[model samples]
Target: MNEEKMLKVEKIRRGTVIDHIPVGRAFKVLKILRISTDPGVTVSVAIHVKSKKMGLKDVVKIEDRILDSSELNKIALIAEGGTITIVEDYSVIKKFVVKLPDIITGILKCSNARCVSNMESAIKPSFTLLSKNPLSIKCHYCEREMETDEIMDSIL
Candidate 1:
């Protein structure tokens, strides 16, 4: 008798998993999170995977490290409409819905070519969610223009 093994998603013992990230943004999220091949913690990321909501999305699996609110907030903007899950003992301990902040602060820089934040450290970058109409965000510093996803690239 021969039986094929079924493929199923495994549960992480203890870690934080950020899912529902927009497709093609997983690697960018990794960069923004400053995640590296650190020996101390394990970081796993998958991009362009099929998702019910996104139809294509990114997933970040982290082990042995828990992120704080600030970090999650930044990720929320990058992975807009994503969900953050804290797992322990293979069970979901907490589920948080990542939402678009009405006003983004100090997390992203202006895309304006001449924005002072680009040249001088004296200026810090910030933005306000102007309209969900086109998912556009306005830079508080230089009044630059960008969409939710564009902000991720600007920060990088």
Candidate 2:
């Protein structure tokens, strides 16, 4: 076994491992999870690593934190094919691929400034998944369509 060929990310005793993030999106994932702001949490990030399945990918290992459904939903929007792994006692427990929901609410703000969700605090932003390949979404209120870049900016 060649040491240079091996990918050696240290294992976490208990936490979450987000793998297969699209290249250059690991920072975005970190920002979304606010991992950097929490000084006490231990985090390891590998960017643009060679991967057989994704060609090139990013990985994030966060110590002492398990993602909730809302956090997973947010991750799914950015990392469509990424997988989440749960670790406990230095052992793999649960693993699954991220899946976008049909209808997402409050997680993303509509790009349209005049949209009712933005105009009225009482109304939560709502959007329906338009397409996954190109990553498009339609705002339920303004009926405006947002593509990948727009969606990335609109995350609340």
Candidate 3:
């Protein structure tokens, strides 16, 4: 049997499909998206799936929901290089890879407890993108650097 024939996942008529998620990260995607908490939303997840481009990857299909910019930003913090496809009437209307912004604000909490963003009530947490491939970021207020793991933990 062909690879396509062996794979069995249902299509969503309207919603967003997140593809190329790194292996074992689909649950994190679900956590960040709060998909399980919502009873009305239908979600399908495939983990450790064979991927020609990524070797092993995960795919998340969210039925009847489209992600917003903030959600995309959160996904980028963890699932960088993953692609988001918006489907309408079972057709892809838009597709794009997740890209981290130069400056990320209010989406992630600074790891440093002493950071001004954390201590001060008026300030919101912010970070500056330092690297992409390895995923490094620097806190705007504390100058503390965070890598992918820390970034993943700090998602708000």
Candidate 4:
């Protein structure tokens, strides 16, 4: 029955398939990717679906679109345990779990309003990882600490 349901969205000839996103985060993932309702992009989102591994998770399939490393990093920040699969010719070309960088740069804004990155001259926001399991970061410029939730809210 699940296989039949899954078939509704036919396999893509090429592009990315992001699976095992935490439940209810498919939209946020879309937001992080800045996917719009543009004509050329075919994006499919499945939320709260049952997964043997995840129990209940979200999946996103974007046709004809390949994400870069920076975008993948943003995704890692949001969906820490998610898996990304790169597909071509309807075959899985590459598949791996997202890994957060030791030092995150420019993708998220500093939570501190008074931070130098937030205040003036082009100091790109950068954060040093404070923890990985329950991810926490500190602004490199201002030493402002931000947890996963805070940093998630600060995505640029």
Candidate 5:
């Protein structure tokens, strides 16, 4: 493919670029980022695209916005190998893979429906990271272990 043909999306002068998202998961990333609420920000999403290293991958570009560390942590749950690139003046100022936090709270709801976190109280869901390879978390209240896939539906 020609260089121009290989480039599916235009470069951003400034903002954050999330790369190497698994194929068909770009929208999930957007949902986790709450992109729909930010109508003013310029965002680009490319899905089901070929990647040299990741095979088929998805990418998300947000113009003039840098995600907070907590936001990045939420992304790590779904996009394990995803890289975050901070762009400035059309150059990458920083780049790193999303890292999972030691403890995750309020970002996702507990899988157990009867868990205290799901009740009509002020209690918020909390989880402790148990593993990263296959991605697992244990609910702090219910002590229920959840795999990565199960966590998707429980996302708040």
Candidate 6:
């Protein structure tokens, strides 16, 4: 055996890989994952890699964590059309598609201040995607049109 052959490569024993995330949201995913708050959980991230849908993107590797549907929904929002691969012993066991929710409610904060959600806490916020045609949605609480770009940059 040579010195090079002596090198060991670490691999995931079991975990989820959230890939194709938009360039800046990798850390946001981490925050949402709350890995730092939990022990026995591991996470790794890579940002601004070459991608087809996203010219640049980030990836998060989570270990020993099973994300629930609601958290998955939040991931879908920030990843903005990504893929999730669940790996066991370095082999892919499951694959999931990330899609923008048809109805996004209370997940995203309306940027339009005049938008009612911004004004009233009593009213839960909601938005319905008007079209996958151009990635646009209508704020249900405010009756304002919000595009994906706007949603991405919103205060939410």
Q: How much does candidate 6 score in TM-score? A: 0.69
Better of 5 and 6 by TM-score: 5
* Residue 81 in candidate 3, Cα distance off native in Å: 0.8
> Which segments of model 1 are wrong by more than 4 Å?
1-8, 116-124, 132-134, 148-150
> Candidate 2 regions off by >4 Å?
1-9
Candidate 6: Cα lDDT at 50: 69
Clash numbers, per candidate: 0, 0, 0, 0, 0, 0
Q: After superposition, how far is residue 19 of candidate 5 from its true place, in Å?
A: 0.2
**lDDT tens readout by residue for model 4, 53-75:** 87899999999998899889999
Q: What clash pairs does model 1 have?
A: none
Ranking by TM-score: 2, 3, 4, 5, 1, 6
Candidate 3 local accuracy as lDDT? 0.89
Alpha-carbon lDDT, every model: 0.75, 0.89, 0.89, 0.86, 0.86, 0.73
Better of 2 and 6 by TM-score: 2
What is the C-alpha lDDT profile of model 1 across 48-148, one tens digit per residue?
77665667877888887777877887887777678888988888899898886898777777888797778888766778887754578887777887986
**Error of model 5, residue 45, in angstroms:** 1.1
Report the lDDT tens digits of candidate 5 across residue range 29-66: 88888899988899988888788787789989999899
Query: Ten-residue segment with the worst summed lDDT in candidate 4?
Result: 1-10
Give the TM-scores of the predictions, in the order they appear. Answer: 0.78, 0.92, 0.92, 0.88, 0.84, 0.69
Q: Candidate 3 or 5, higher lDDT? A: 3
| Segments of candidate 4 deviating more than 4 angstroms | 2-9
lDDT of 2 at 45: 89
Q: Give the CA lDDT, 0 to 100, for residue 77 in model 6.
A: 66
Backbone clash total, candidate 3: 0
Residue by residue across 1-156, what tens digits does model 6's lDDT show? 321132113346788878877788888788766777888887777677666566787878888776777678778766757788778877878888888788987667887888768887898778887876456778887678877567766524
